[model samples]
Structure formats: structure tokens, C-alpha cells
Target: MSIYGYESLTGRTAVVTGAASGMGEATARRLAAHGVRVALLARRAERLDALAGKIAADGGQALAVTADVTDAASVRAAAERVRDAYGPADLVVNSAGVMLPNPVDAGRTDEWARMIDTNLGGALHVIDAFRADLLAAAAEGRPADLVNVSSIGAHVVFPNYAVYGATKAALTQLSASLRTEFGPRGVRVSNVEPGLTDTELGSHIDNAELSQALDGMFQAFGQALTADDIADLIAYTTSRPRHVNLRQLVVLPTVQA
Candidate 1:
């Protein structure tokens, strides 16, 4: 009766960042359906609460907690709350991110800093905070997974997305490096990269021309990939056999290539 093909996760706890919407929201919903206790994290308290309420209404366990991933102190506080409520997450998903397209010639340094801080810094903060919990789960012989949501843009660079791509590239390397260090200890680390998914990510682009260009690009595929598509992949990756590790997966719309 499990949609994910794995029911061993029934009693596990998962902490998902960016759960207010997009891929993170879909992932949380998917996990809840599989009976995993989910902790939703994002800066939007109301949205988080709404999601938690919906999950509860569906007969799934969920807790909504608000935190800004860009702030280490905020992340730590959210970690403490989850630790107290769930005891330690068996799965952690770093789906919090931002995409702001601006040419280097524009001198929009603030956008670059925001991308680096949220995309890369946020991932590190979440991992560092919940690392001990992952270790504890492994020590108890439970399969644990750390999923970092990246972007195919990391490898395929467009005109003005250099800095954003670099952050994602760094994330991919970070996941790979962590897998080497953590895989031996029974923890799974994975980097998930998706191309041109339809999300609020592109709306942050302050460049009017680039925003229109991005809109045209997103429409080129007829319709871009949905958050649910990526969520399905996330579910499948985490549900793989314990010995099997999906170190990295790049998912793009068929028309992308």
C-alpha cells in the first residue's frame, strides 16, 4: 500500500528545508504519505503551518517550524526544535535555494552573495547541525540519507547564471566529498540536480530583460518540469536498498537537451 515501494521508512523522521513550496513541499508530502514524520522548515511560518495542517488532515504526521536557512543561528534554533520534537532526523533534505539572474557587468554583487549564502551556506549549516543525528541513526543500523537539491545549471552555464551555477557546482562537489567521508560510516549523501523546473526561483531576477528571457526559456519546453517530478525522484532515491547509493542524479525535461 506504499506508493514509494518502500515501507521501511514508516517510523523514520525527516527534516525538509524549503518545505513551504516547490520541490521541498512535494517531497514532504511524498514522505508523509509513506508515513515518515516530517519536519517542515522555511521562513514562512504561515505557509509551513498550512502545510503541516494539510498533512495532518491527510492523516500524516508533520511539524512546521520557521527558520531562515541563511542564518546559522536560525538554522541552529530550528535544528534544536526538530531535535527536541523528533529526536534526530533519519533523513535531511536541503532544498532551500534562490536563483537570481544578473550579468557580471551589471555589478549586482548583492544577488551573487545571496545565491552563495543560501545555496551553499544553507546546505552546510543544515548538514552540520543534523550530522550527529545521522551518525546516531547509522549507529543504530538505520539507513540514513542526506539529499542536497542542486541544479543542472551547475554544469550547463547560460549567459548570466555564472554565480548561481558556481554555487550549485560547489554543492555537487560538497555532496560528493561528504559521500566519501560518510558513506563508509553507513550514511548516504546525494546531490540532485534538475534543469529548468517551474518554480518561484526565476521570479527573483531583478533584470527585466533577463526575466523575460527566462520566461521565454521556461516556455520553450512547452512546460517546464514540475516540483512533483523532482519529488518523485527524491522519494525513489531515498527508498533505494540500503546498500545502494544514488550518489548523484541529474534530471531534466526531455526537451532540455
Candidate 2:
């Protein structure tokens, strides 16, 4: 059980949601480097195809499936495509999310719904759609892994992030409960929480005041964590032995309190 043993994911198949950009892109790239056959799922077909091409160019097996996580049928179809092309998936990563900054009193119901639907509901769709395959893979003696990407907001309370935080918190709990239920069945589940990473999460914030506050917070931290930092953690966790589960890991910049 060397620390680096999981680094070689040769012959394994992985399904990665939100594989178009940011942490998802980095994670997919890293997994492919380790010889994992990766299925890229995202709303952007062009981006997914481009990424798949790059991975293939690097001598890795890759598939690009365009699907919206918010739609259960779409997710199921994507999972089926992956199974048809690469057998059962040995790994699944749910990273699709949305963040819109607004106060609870502002009556921004649409934003709230979008956040919940994409972040929490989307994760549910992916897990439920793929749970059967994951279980079957484990039954065959090849342990499966699931990594759900959460956020620091999942733990801490922050203004204008009520809906976003709630969604992430729910995802965290879901991952924990899933881990308990599946661990005995030879499936490893983990939640990776990242703090203040430089991504497009803040772009949805249209409120000037809220945007300023968030920018100030990031600046106060001096440097925000990079997407690659989170990707590295996910890669390490997924590479572990069948009996070893990393559970929950929270990563933040040193300057972030």
C-alpha cells in the first residue's frame, strides 16, 4: 500500500461530470495520464470533444458525451454510452455546480432554484444512474470510487451565498451517507472541498455589492487555490487501494482562514 500505488490507474474507466473546464478538466487530464479510460460529460459538446482528442493524442482512451446533469434521462443516457464504450465505470466524479450570490430576502428565486438543481439534483442524477454499474464492478473484485466535489462554503456560513452553501452542504451530506452505505459493498466515496479556488463560480454574481465582497475576500487571502491543487487531491484519493477510503478532504490556500 504505497502512497503512489493508486497513481497507476491503468485499465480503469472513469466518468467525470463537468469535464469541460476548471477542476473537472484538470482531474480528467490527470486521470488519463495515469492510463485511465475517461468519459467526459458536460453541457459543451465541442469542449468535451476537444479534450477527448487531446487525451487520445497523448495515447489515452477517452470518450466525449454531451449531457446535462440536471436532466436525469440525459445523465442516464450518458452513463449508458460510457458503459457501452468502456465497460463498467471504475470511477465517477460529480463536479457540476452553480453559484449565484444573492441575499435570501432579495426574492431571487430563480437563482436559488438553479443552484439547487444543478449542484444537488445533478449529483443525485449521476449517482443514481451509475450506482448499479458501480456495484457490479465491485462485485467483480474491482473496487469502484466516487468523488463528489463540494466547497468550503459547504462548511462555513457566508453572506450572499446562502443558496450556494445550502446546495454544497446537501452534497456533502449525500456523499457521507452514500459512503456509509457503499463502503461495505466495496465502493469508496469521498467529498473534496475546496476553498476560494480561482474559477468561474463568481461570474454569476450580478449584484455589485456581493461581487465586491467576494473579490475582497479573495484578495484578503493573498492567493486563491488553483484548480490543479484540487485535481491532485482527487487523483490521489481515487488511486487508493480498494480497502482504503479517504472520506472527506478540505483544501484551502494557506492565507484563507
Candidate 3:
């Protein structure tokens, strides 16, 4: 098939967690433009609603679902809602995550737990909630895709990012294993690892020193990859032919080592 043919995603339904902002929002918009029905799942109802409105205005179908990925019940409920509204999702994007930066000795146990809950545990919940549906779609000879958003920290560590990196590393491995196990069943899983993107993800860091350091790093790395960059990669992956599974994609600015 021609490369251009892979850009069209019409008649497909996608559920994007963290669809309220940043990469999640961008992915929703991109997929919607290609004629995909999108279910926007996020904790921020207002943001999701606004995004859904925008997508609708652009002549796309979208559903705004208020959900907290860290909560298993909420994730399952969101999946049910999506299935009810749009049938089985052809694509599932696990983009909900949290990042908290601090030294291990900072006594910030709460922040660490929050990061772990949202990043690793939350992704697991979303994947598990929708696994059956995805596999079912695959069984029917349809293309089913699962995209997990990881981070550069998953491959490389940085100061004050121990917990966050650990969570991402876990997510990376989870995606890899899921891909291997499900590939034979006609389900394709991919990991999108982004580096130093401009997003509100860093705002969760309560430590002043760590926050300042991270901000400085971003400033130095100027021209960091935008959410759109990662979103574009996701669109490309999901739009490919049923037999084509782009397993792993790592995106970063040219300046980023």
C-alpha cells in the first residue's frame, strides 16, 4: 500500500486517555480529522468537553468522558461508556500519566505514590479494561491497535526523576510484552516514547529546586518536541495497514542527546 493510503483512519473508533490536554488532545484532534470517532477520556471534564466541541466543529465525531485513570472503577466505566456510544474501539491510546520530580530523600512519599498510581498503575487499568474488546476485534480479522505513551526517561535516568523514570520503564516493558503476546492474535501494540515535550506534566513537581532544574533543562534544550509531534506519530501508527505494526517510535528534538 502507498504511504499516503495509511493516513486515512475513517470509520474507526479511538479511545484516548488523557485526552484533555497536551499529546492526548493533539492525538484526538489528528485522529478525528482523519474521520475517526474519538472518545476523550480524562479527569478534567471541562477540558475534555471543550476539545470535543472543537472536534465536532471540525466535522468530526467525539465523546467527552470524564474519567480518572488511576481509579480502576473509573477506567472500566469509561471503557463501558465508550463501547456503548461507539461500539468496540479500534484503537486504545494510554496517554494518561503523571510526573513528579524530587530527590529520593525528600520525604515526598505522597508525590511518589501519585506518580506510580497514575503512570504505571493507571496504564495497566486502561489496558486491562479494554483488552478483551481489542482482542475480539482482532479475532474478527480487523485491525486493532494499542498505543502506550512512555518517556525518554524510560531508557535513560536523570536526577530527581527516579520514581517517574521507574514508572515509565515499567510501562515500556508492559507494552513490549503485550505486543509479543497479542501479535499472534492480530492485535498490534506500540509504544510512543517522547523526550522533553512542552506540557503541563512538569507542573506536578512540588519541589522548587527540581522544578527549576527541569525548567532550565527545557530552556536549554530549546525547540523541544511538541505534543503534536508525538500525536502525529500515533496517528501514523494507527492508520497503517492491518498487517503493518509500527512497534516502537521514539521522538525527540535534534538537540536532545
TM-score: the better of candidates 2 and 3 = 3
lDDT of 3 by residue, 1-257 (tens): 46656544888889999999899999999999988999999999999999999999999999999999999999999989999999989799999988888888987889888989998999999988999988998999988999999999998989878998999999999999998799999999999899989988888777788889889988898788889988889988888888889998888899998
Global fold similarity of model 1 (TM-score): 0.97
TM-score to true structure, per model: 0.97, 0.96, 0.97
Alpha carbon lDDT of residue 33, candidate 1?
89
Error of 1 at 145 (Å): 0.4
TM-score of 3: 0.97
Candidate 2 per-residue lDDT over residues 87-189, each given as its tens digit:
8898999988888978899999999999899999999999998898889888998869999999989989988788999999999999999978998999999
Lowest summed lDDT across 10 adjacent residues in model 3 is found at 1-10
Q: List the residue pairs that clash in candidate 3.
A: none
lDDT of 1 by residue, 1-257 (tens): 35448677688899999999999999999999888999999999999999999999999999999999999999999999998998889899999999988888988889989999999999999998899999889888888999999999888978988999999999999999999888999999989999989988877888899999988987778878999999889888988777788999999888989
Give the better candidate number (1 or 2) by TM-score.
1
The 10 consecutive residues of candidate 2 with the worst lDDT sum are 1-10
lDDT (C-alpha, whole model) for all candidates: 0.91, 0.90, 0.90
Residue 35 shift from truth in candidate 3, angstroms: 0.7
The total of clashing pairs for model 1 equals 0
